[model samples]
Target: MPHTDVQMDTHDIALETPPADVFMAPSICKSDLLAGKSYSHFSPIPAHISDDMTTECVLGVDEAGRGPVLGPMVYALYYLPMELQQSLLADTHHFDDSKVLTPEVRSSLMRKLCTDGSDLHRASGWATRLLSARDISAHMLQPAQYNLNAQAMDATIDLIKEVLAKGVNVKEIYIDTIGRPEVYQKKLERIWPTIRITVAKKADSLYPVVSAASVCAKVTRDAALDVCYEPYQDTAVNEDKATEASTHVAWGSGYPSDARTSTWLKQNIDPVFGWGNECRFSWGTAKELLEGKTADVKVDWPVEDDANGDMRMTDFFAAKTEAGGDELVDWFGKRVTEEMEDF
Candidate 1:
């Protein structure tokens, strides 16, 4: 994939990736998220905005699907007037409807948020950054690793900057943090000196704005997962897999702990490429499945012969041949001892 440069100044928030069925879902494009690339989407700037930079609005950032092994990690931001924070989000719209995070409720809330002329839609604005499983795995698996926390922080910052640049009167910002909440909060404060930034462990459950942001992120991830299997369904390695891959029939929750997901991965993995881009190759479970003893093929990666003396498997075999050593004895690392019982 080519390096994608996001246009920050333009209101054209449509993702630059391949087109998708717009009617499918509001915040998610399955192909875009699972196409081995990361992308961002911005909701249309709310028309109920005044040009006053002094206008006080509260914004929140939250993420979803961070632990899942099969779907995109979505980072979302929501901003609305500070006065309306209670009246609009909490009371009227019920952004904090549930004591626990509920996927079903989030989906329903997201639909309302996206609906035209809805109070939630007309008064607030939002954006999302969908980090694809493939892109994430690629970064972390590379020689110079970029960890998930860093990637997440960058994505969250990008969403906030996008909203700020679009002239949102952001006065206070709240974020659901991954690790080192104080450090994250300080970093965000350094970036936006004027805005009061708050980063908490469960900011989503505590703050109404953060809860709304969580709803957007969760709904986007769930919808993306539903469509993630579409691309691989037709071109599956086997007919049985093709039948099963039709819209996540047995794909499970995309978590490594889930037996159904592990079964799906085992049954559908390609010996050469592992599973499709839906799987995060950087995850320990994925690595073990692809490279461990149970793998269908034991692939030996080619190594460069550097001046410092790098070695390949073939080099060792060749050295044994030159030494006139028995291949079986050397391969098995076995040697007979005088007192050995099983030697």
Candidate 2:
């Protein structure tokens, strides 16, 4: 009887259909498989796969909204089959760190990747809840960094458990380093002993799996922002409240160093709401507000200068009065001297 053999490729396992004569008795290999001819021929697979039968699933984890002044921390997990890794990498060639991609490009890529059917499993979790500026101010809460780090880990672990429940065989977990890579890995190991955790700097940019996780996390957070904006718009219009307007206003970046965001914070200082309804009170912007600092005091707009280079309030009035001193007095039915008397 002729020997039978099986071959596998990166994308799939190719099983050769046996010949008709094999119906009586199939030839089977009784000797141990040679290293070069068996699984050892290919590079070692990710640890997530054990005994060739278990499906190899890579769990990519990433967090979003870490730098935002408002909104909860969002962590997402993406479980993708190891076989599809190469194809996914090719499809998302433009994929890099989510921070590096423009919002428009990120949105376009996200729509394309999410629709593809490749046995992908995903889960996301938000922080306990968005800490309001009022709560922070009243309780004298810790800095934003403390709150953010705490929430990030909380969301991450919760999402991991969710993916596990969905029957995803998560063998290895990759997380983009948040505070310190080594420290985070140690912490994560304590929570999940069975899983191998790799925390690396800019892992999302370096790994396709991590980048896919990032895209999903960002899309989910952005959707939450849309929901947050809806209630804010309703409050601004129906309540006839300008203070509420600042809450919903998309102040550029919403960071303390941002002039527009700082100015908005200063303009709408509410003891109850702190800087603004949406402003994260634990941030430096809220700290400045609590210290009674004003954004307008930071810098002043340039004033126009007259011909003599002296700063003038109205260039039009000065230029026009000099050109038509007599005509201006006649039109107003008043003498130039009479008008200048008050000045």
Tens-place lDDT per residue, model 1, 216-322, is: 77677767776786665543346665553223345656766666667888988999889877878878778888888888889787987686377777765556555
lDDT of 2 by residue, 153-217 (tens): 76577767765654557678888865899988998899889988899988898777787667655
Query: Among these predicted structures, which one has the highest TM-score?
Result: 1
RMSD of each: 14.6, 26.1
How does each model score on lDDT?
0.75, 0.49
Per model, how many backbone clashes are there?
0, 0
Native-referenced Cα lDDT, model 1: 0.75
Where does candidate 1 stray beyond 4 Å?
1-24, 50-54, 97-101, 232-248, 304-343
Candidate 1 clash pair list: none
Query: Each prediction's TM-score against the native?
Result: 0.76, 0.55
